[model samples]
Structure formats: C-alpha cells, structure tokens
Target: MAVVASLTDRKSVQPGIQSLVDLVSGGMEQVNQIILSKAGSNVELIPEIAKHLISSGGKRLRPMLTLACADMFGYQGDGHVTLAASVEFMHTATLLHDDVVDESDMRRGKLAARKLWGNQASVLVGDYLLGQAFKMMVDVGSLEALRILSEASAIIAEGEVMQLGAAKDIATTEAQYLKVIEAKTAALFAAAAEVGPVVAGESAEMKKAARSYGMELGLAFQLVDDALDYGGSSADLGKDVGDDFREGKITLPVVFAIQRGDDKDKAFWKRCLETDGIEDGDLDHAIELMSRYDAIADTVERARSYGDSALKALDRLPAGAHQTALAEAVAFCIARVS
Candidate 1:
C-alpha cells in the first residue's frame, strides 16, 4: 500500500520517465502487439501463465530502452519492434525464473507465477517465452543483434548461479556482489541498448556508447532497488519491504553495514543472514545498523555515480529528443529512492 501511495506521489513529481514513455508510445504499442501475438499458444496453460506475469504492472523499461535507442539513431524500420518484444520476453523469462529461485511470493504486486502455478509450469512457460523471443530476434534478421541477446542470456544465467552461491554468505565482498549484478542485471540492459544501434546500422562508437549507457543505468537501477528494500515502503518497492532481508540477500546496504559495523554488528549479521535465523525486530535492527553506518545513503550515492556514468555515455550521441529522454530515464532510475 505504501509503495502504491508512493507511486501516486511520484507520478505527480516525476515526468522524466513519463516523457520517455510518451515518446516511445507508438513503438511501444507495436511492441505490445508483438508480445501478445507471440505469447499465444495452442496449449491453454502457456498463455495463461505467460499472460499472468506479462499483464502485471511492470514498466516494461527494457523494451522501451530498445525502442528509444533505435529511434535516437533515426532508424525507420520495423526491426526495433520485433527486437523490443524479444527484449521483453527475455526479461519476463528471467523474472519467472528469478521468482522461483528466490522463492518469492510476490512480483509486480501480485502473487509470483511460481506461487500460483507450480515451478515446473512457470519454468516451462518461461522457456516457451524465451523460445518465442529467439524466433522474434531471428525475424529481425540481424545476426549481430541475435548474437548480443543470446550472449546476454547466458551471462544472466551465470549471474543467477553466482547469486545462488553468494546468497546468505555474509563474507561476500563488494566486488563479488557487483560482478553478480553486472552479469544478472546490467548485461541485459547493455545488450538491449546495444542491439538498437546494431539494427540501425550505427557505427561501433555509437553502439558502444549505447551499451555503456544501459549498463550504468542498470547498475543505478538495481542499486536503488537494493537501498529501497530497507528504507522504502512496500508501495515504493512493489514487494514487501525487507523482502531481501527475509531472503538473506547480500545486497549493497548489507555489505556496507557489515563492512562498517563493529564486532557485535558483524555477529548480528551472521546470526540473521548467515544462519537465516531472522526473528521479529531483526529487520528493524538491520535498518538501524544501515542508518548508523550511512549504508543506504552511501548506496544511493553509488547509484548517483553510476547515473553520472550513464549520462556521460549519452554524450557520444547527437543531441535529439530521444537522447534527452534516455538521459532523463537514467535520472529517473536513480530518483526512485531519492
């Protein structure tokens, strides 16, 4: 409820993302059509499970990034739409898989597909969506685009595996955590943005710039989400506050708190995280420790640093409305916590 309320308030003050959404509305409509068309199947369960998550209230930001990046380069082809759908499918598949892996009950403010349907159904449907995604990519007929996305898929899986190994490990270093997110999250963002330039036949420099922008933006996005898990309300997060804490996730705030804490604080983290012995008031204590060490603030500052890198990445592109929207998009990602 608080996340919803926060979203309502944010809508009045945040026009940056809205501007980008509006700018890409026509293309998004096409992407939506493609998504719906591709999500259909002869088996009723496939569409049922796929539509459950697809119709959920995610911003579809990755696909929008694809559309905007291609438009920024003055691409006048239908390839962007198909590629955008591919990006969305890839994202959706990951979400389904991630929820299962995380044992999460909620996603986009609804019961996770794994909770409603069995994990097997969720995973199989996710695979189906991925299959459709690759088909769409091949339809685009750009070997380079297909290659980038396919590589990203493998990297994302590796990231998830890395997180599995690192979960509840209080000793996880900042570097290791960063590597996990870079692979798990930023890779897709990078690939999504890069393919736009690839489809448009843009130069290597422009493609690299777009990829850099997406990578940094994604880092900022996930960092903000990490900070919000402790400080943000359920409405602001779309999931319960402290979900990461409950899951014993080794997020940036947790890492910072551990690093800055005294021996007693380390003991506390070990009890709650390493052993998964969380109890009432533990989340509050965790938040208090994070606040004492300025962990949340420091995390937001780090996100701001990444946001700056994202903006700088845009410098390589010629000035245009799409470019402006993309820059604003980066700012918006960091602004969620602010």
Candidate 2:
C-alpha cells in the first residue's frame, strides 16, 4: 500500500486518520462537552492549567478509540461518551505530567504546560485531571470499565518509572525498551478501547479483540513517534526534532545504533547521552551515526510490524465504517515519519 511505503518514502501520500476523525465526530462532540464541563473548577488555576492543555490541539485519539469502538457495536448510550471523556482526561493528565517529567519545552507545537504554569502547577493540574477522570468513571457506574482504566493508570505510572530507570542508559536493550513503551503508552490505548466494548455490553471475545487492536496500535504509534524524534521536522512532529536525543531518552533507534556501533561510536553516545556533554556538532553526528546504522529505517520497520498486527486485530471486530477507519488509523500513525 502507498501508505505502508510512506513509512520510508516521503513522496508517497499517506492515507490520513481523517476517516476515523469523521466517523467519530459526533461522539467526539459529546466527549468535548463532557471534557469542557468536567475540566471546570472554582479554583482558578485548576481550570487555567487544565484548560490550557485541554484546549491545546491534541488529536484526542485515545478518547476517539473509545467512542469508535463503542459505536462499532451499534451502541446507543451516554455511557460511551462519559467513558470517552474519562479516557481523554487520563491522557491529558499523563501529558501534563509527562512534560514536567521530561522537562520538555514544547507540546503539540506549543509551549508545554509546565513552561507556562511551572512544574508544581502542571503536576497538580494533572492530579486534578485524574481526579475528574475517576469521578466520571464512577458516574458511568461500570465496574469493569473502571477496573480496566484504573489498572491502566497504575500501569502507565509504572511505565513512566521504568522509562526513568532506562533513561540515558545506552546499554538498554530492545526488550527493556519495549517493556517501557508497552506499559507507558499501550496500556492506556488498551484500556480506552476495551472500555468501549465493556460499556456497550459486548462479549469478552470482542473486547479482547478491541484491546489487542488498541494495544498493537499504541505500540505502532509510539514507535513511529520515536522514529520521528529523529527523522521528522518540528512542523510535522509538533515538537522540536532530536528532542529525545537531547533529553537522553533511550528509544528503539538509539538502542539499535548503540548495539551496532563501534567503540568510538559507543563513546560518543556515552558522552552525549549518558554524560550530557553535548557539543555543537553532537546532534548532527548523532543523526549521522543513526543513519549509518539505518536505525531510523529499522525503527519504522518495527512500527510497520506492529501496525500490521493492529490491522489484523481489527479484522476480528464487527465489520463497518469504524473498522475501515480504525485500520486506516493504524496506517496513518506509521506514515507520520514520512
């Protein structure tokens, strides 16, 4: 497919996620309403910090998954909307916390919340978002959905801690890195999708399939993001290129490069990443080393593999517009590197 080829070939036009966006538009409107309503607080700073990130132009993909999965089963209820909003809050909370933890300056092409509000405010607002999310979950009154999301929250936290442990460690293996992303990123995707079926009263088999789709898709999504941190421009990536490298984040491409590098290359990684002794030519040299090893290409290849698995998981779901859009969504994610 042209979209698959687009993983490595920028000239090929990608099939975008617009289809999924269109399919879930109505449900997303409800989700937006809930999000805005719930984000409100008498504490001025709470709403200020919360709305700053909430109003920022994230794609709201996780909540969209919840809505689409529920709608796929021909569900007709407000519960899905509530759950979708909760998923979004959980995601927003994570981002708020992530920016602070990563010491990031930008998000979605704008100044990160931490930059504007400071770390203490950003973290507190993130906690507030989580509180609002849990309250909404209880409002939905689905113990199963609550269980899935609560567990995901805890898993995501563990993943964050895992990433901290692996950070700047050039010796980090591919297996170790995978464990980090699977928990930090894919856990929420799995929960967002599984809750749809749970709220819709679908069978366990279908819920399992949906969770598989989401988990695999999340992995693909994150892998592509890792690739883009090196391969893509800021305009396309919504953040400065090489941010991961600058932050000493150990990702798949970095893992591959470190494994394949010679002693000199290894020493360079140690200086730039482990010791944070970056010089003027360091970023360029780092990119060159990754290119020499074909690290970015290999990382994209891995993402395509996960994307393939995500597409297969979609096949087990009910057939409809949602399935097609969701499948295309997988392709769209991987194609971002192009």
Candidate 3:
C-alpha cells in the first residue's frame, strides 16, 4: 500500500499562506472553538444572523495572525485563544455593518446577512457580537489588550464614516483612501498582532514588530483586494467582480486612473462615479480606462511595496517556523494579485 503525504507537505512545494495556516493550525482550532461558542446566544435571531456570516468561508486570517504571533512569543496560556476570537468577532461585526452601509447583496459568495434578515437585524446582531467580543477581552484580564482593541474599534468606525463621505467622490485622493483603509482594516490587524505579545509578556520592541507586520500586511491585503475588484474573477473576490465599481468606491485603481486620465476619461469617471449615472457599458469602459492608465498594475506594485515592509517587520523577531511562516503569509498576500 502506498502512503500519501500530508497536505502540509504537499503545500510546502511552495511557501505560501497554506504553510502559515498549517503552522498555526493548533492554536487556530482553539480560536475556532471559542469563536463558535461565544457566537452562540440565547436570543434565537442573534445566532441565526451571526452564523450566516460567521460560517461563510472567510480565511480567518486576522485571528490566525493573533494565534501565530502569540505562539511565536512562546505563549502557552489560553488568553491568546480568547483574544483571537475577540478579534474575529470585531471583524465580523464590521462586516455586518459594512454590508448594510454599502448596500451589498453578497458576502463570502453568499447573500449578505442584511439581504436575508434586513438592515435592523444585521446592525443589532453586529452590536451583539461587538458586546460579546468586549466581554471576552475583559474576561482575559488584559487591560492593555482591551485598550488596544477598543481604540481600534473606534478607529474602524471613523474609517467607515470617512469612506461614506468619500464614496462617489472622484476627487478622493490616494492618501485619503489609504487613511480610510488604515483605520477600517489595518487598525484591527495591528491590535490583533500587538496583543499577542502583550499577553505573552514579550518586550515592547517585539510588540511593535508584530504590530508593524500586521499593519503592513493588512495594507497590502486591502490594496490587492482593491485591484482585484476590477481585474479578478468573482471566485477570487468572493463577491461580484464589479461591486466596488457599482458602489462608487474610490479605490486605488480609480485614484490612479483618474490622476492620469485625459479630459474625456475624467468626464467618464465623473459620470460613473460622482453622479452615480452608471450605464451598462460603464464597467467595461472603466476597466479599459484603468488598463490604459496601468492603474491595476500600479496598485499591485504598491501592494508589493507594503508586502516588503511586512517582511522587514518580521526581521526583528527571533528565527523560527512561526516567523518564517508569517513572512510567507506576507508573500501569499501579494501573490493573490499575481
């Protein structure tokens, strides 16, 4: 009888996200258990709505980062598990809120919670998850962790408001868009990575290194997602390919294209984005213009630069499988676009 190699071994043919997932699988299992347990509620509607999105096939990358960072610091306590779950709950809450705000129809390749349960339930359930998340953080007895996460929560809310104002505004600058994503997406990631070392009693320098790694990784991840909006398949995006375009989101591609476009191209963007006067062929034309201006390629190049930063951030940490896997994770994020 022939014996088959483990999936991890096969995946090791190339160093990528799967290797990171394998490295952190033990801790991630604990995090998953905590996430499922805490996601339950006495109120029937809460679990129903929460599960709709929770079970939806997100990579759970943020929580996994918390687990990996803690493990890298030799943390053996259960605090990282609880904190990882808390990070995920915070993320899920934001997603529920985001779908409602964006008026999105799908999430993770399925109908959004709002589409099935209405905006009220989505918002309320999001609130409930957030409350539970805080409860867990408090239970961990890590005051510093709680402070970091709470601040991230406030920053994320601010980012949402910033995005709301920037929407359909073709004049939105690249700096403004970067600011929006830094708050909305990267803040939680930084907090998640930072808290791991805090709980592990690691040095402040190590904590800063972890935080830097996560922030740069998050930026690269979002930039790739933004570029993929115009160039990737729905299978890759887990939502409609042109959802950002339809929503009048001023992503990096749009920013670059607008900056470099001529008079006719600017007018076209103004109609499709600013006035919400999108026509049938507008998406195709928008893609054409973005391609003509090399917007997608430039956005991808920016993501790669951030990916480089993330790898450098990991250089401060001690050498180990976890650190190597974390660096590979950064490579994997950039590879998503490639």
Candidate 4:
C-alpha cells in the first residue's frame, strides 16, 4: 500500500491545464451560459437534478476539447460555443445515468443526483439533458457534427450495456474491458474533437488527427482512472476510492491481477466482487494483491503508451499556442495519477 501510495503522490513535473484553460476560458464562458440556459425546464426536479451534477466539479475537459480544437483551426462562428455546451450536456447526461447504472452514491466529492433525488428522477433528468443536447446540436445545423455526435451517443449506450453484462464477471478479459472503455468513454472524446474540424471545415486529415488524439487521450484518461481507483485518494477521482472494486467493475488492473493471481487470490476476488462478500480488510488486501502483481504499475504504463499515441496524434496538427495547450492537456490528464 505504501509503495503504490508513494507513486501516486509523487510530484509530476508535466504541464498542467492552465494553458488549456486560459486558451478556452472565453469560449467556456459561453458554453457555461448556454449550459445553464438550456438546463432549465418546467419540471422543477429536472432543473434540480440536472444542475446538481452539472455544477459538480468535473474538469469540463470534453467541452474544453471542443473549444480548443475548433479555436486552433480558426473556427470563427458561435457554433463552436453551442456545440461545446452540447458536448457538456451529453457528458452530464451520461454521468447522471451512469450513477444510476453503477449504483453509485457519490460524484465529484458530492452526493450523486441519484442519492439525493431517487434513481427515477436522476434517470429522467438525464433523458431531459440528452434531449437538450440534441436540440442544441440541431441548432448548430452541421449535419456532419450531428451525425458524429448521434453515432457516438449510440456507441456510448452500447458500451454501457456491455459493461453491465461484464460486471462482476471475473472471467472478463483485458480485450473485452478495453472495448467497454473505448465505447463508453472514448467515443464521446472522439466525437467531441472530430466535430470541431467538421464544423470548422478543416480537411478530413485534420479531422482524423483530432479524433485520434481524443480517442487516445480518453483511453489514457480512463486507464489512469482505473489505476487511481486503488492508488489515489478520493480527491483525485472525486468519488470514494475502491468504488470500482465494490461495484465489481473489471477495470484493467483487476484483469491483470486476476490473470496473475493464484487460486487463493481467485477465491478472494470471487468473494469480494463476484458474490459481494467483502469484509473490513478486503480493500486493503485487494490493493496489496494488485501491488504484488504489479497490476497498478502495469496499468499506468499502458496509460503512458496511450498518452504517447495522443501526443503523436497532436503532431499531425499545425503548431501554435492552441496546439501546445492541447498537447499539454494530454500530459496533464496522465499526470493525475502520478
């Protein structure tokens, strides 16, 4: 525990999001305003629950990606702002639904919408937010952007369903779990970045670059998160540590641990996750086993590989302050677990 803990707490010299935030702050203001205005509804609970998660302290990274990608390519219209807000709405809607689906009690260091308002209200508000997201996308009037986002939405749902099917199934393979995160997490990231060039009328080559950067960055982001579930504090994830283990999620590290662990270890995982028979010391034991097997270290190593790929994708774009900030964003994301 101490060794992994030390690694997570070690100082990261990598660049942070300040550059990215400075670059996108003006546009993000517009995105925020649009978000608040569109979140309103006649139904009181809708606004209540929607605002709860919306105002939570997520980095707003996906929307920022939209703004940065568009700005880097000189997108001059306000359409990018609308689309950024739409991206955020899509993300918020997913979080709301995810909390319900994962049976989570917390989000962003706060009570989950489902915890405060029932699962039904949380789900309905999530639906409302999704509807709002599409309406905003339609208002942008880019059929290509609309198509990209709509398809991403469907893929994300499929990822969720796939995850539901995989949960607590310790037999879940590493490749299968990657498929889940690629769909559930990376799809929106790809769409968020690709739509920027789609709306900005950049060449298809640039669109491909942006999508690849986003998809790779998203994979690194989620891989880091999987590692952090055991190695990081609640502050890093904005949720209780070990939530994945408690939920029986077959994250990358769990896959590695299971493959490398012995029969006694297999029984332990089955009891804690498969059968929900966790005891007081189980989380510590889980972390110990993961450490013994280098599961967490290997997961972080895989994240760096994806992070490197994200940087390579960035190299395909024009070099400038925006490009630099976007590049630093990848490093910053991976640094979260450092």
Q: List the residue pairs that clash in candidate 2.
A: none
Question: For residues 12-128, what per-residue lDDT tens digits would candidate 4 score against the true structure?
Answer: 224588999999999999999999999998888888888888888788999999998999988899888899899999999999999999999999999999999999999989999
lDDT of 2 by residue, 1-338 (tens): 11222223434324578988999899899899888999998899998888888887888999999999999999999899999999999999999999999999999889998999899999999999999999999999999999999999999999999999999999999999999999999999999999989999999999998999999999999999998888889987778999999999999999999999999999999999999898998888988998999999999999988888887778889877788788778878877874
| C-alpha RMSD values across all candidates | 5.2, 2.9, 5.1, 4.9
**TM-score of each candidate structure, all chains considered together:** 0.95, 0.95, 0.95, 0.96
Give the clash total for candidate 4: 0
Q: Candidate 3 regions off by >4 Å?
A: 1-15
Model 3: per-residue Cα lDDT over 261-322, one tens digit each: 99999999999999989999999999999999999999999998887777678888767778
Superposition error at 299 for model 1 (Å): 0.4
Candidate 1 per-residue C-alpha lDDT over 161-264 given as tens digits, one digit per residue, 9 for 90 to 100:
99999999999999999999999999999999999989999999999999998999899899999999999988888789999999989999999999999999
Poorest stretch of ten by lDDT in candidate 3: 1-10
Candidate 4 differs from the real structure by a C-alpha RMSD in angstroms, to one decimal, of 4.9
In Å, residue 302's CA in model 3 sits off its true spot by 0.3
TM-score of candidate 4 relative to the true fold: 0.96
Would you list the clashing residue pairs of candidate 4?
Answer: none
Give the clashing pairs for model 1. Answer: 2-235, 3-235, 3-236, 4-235
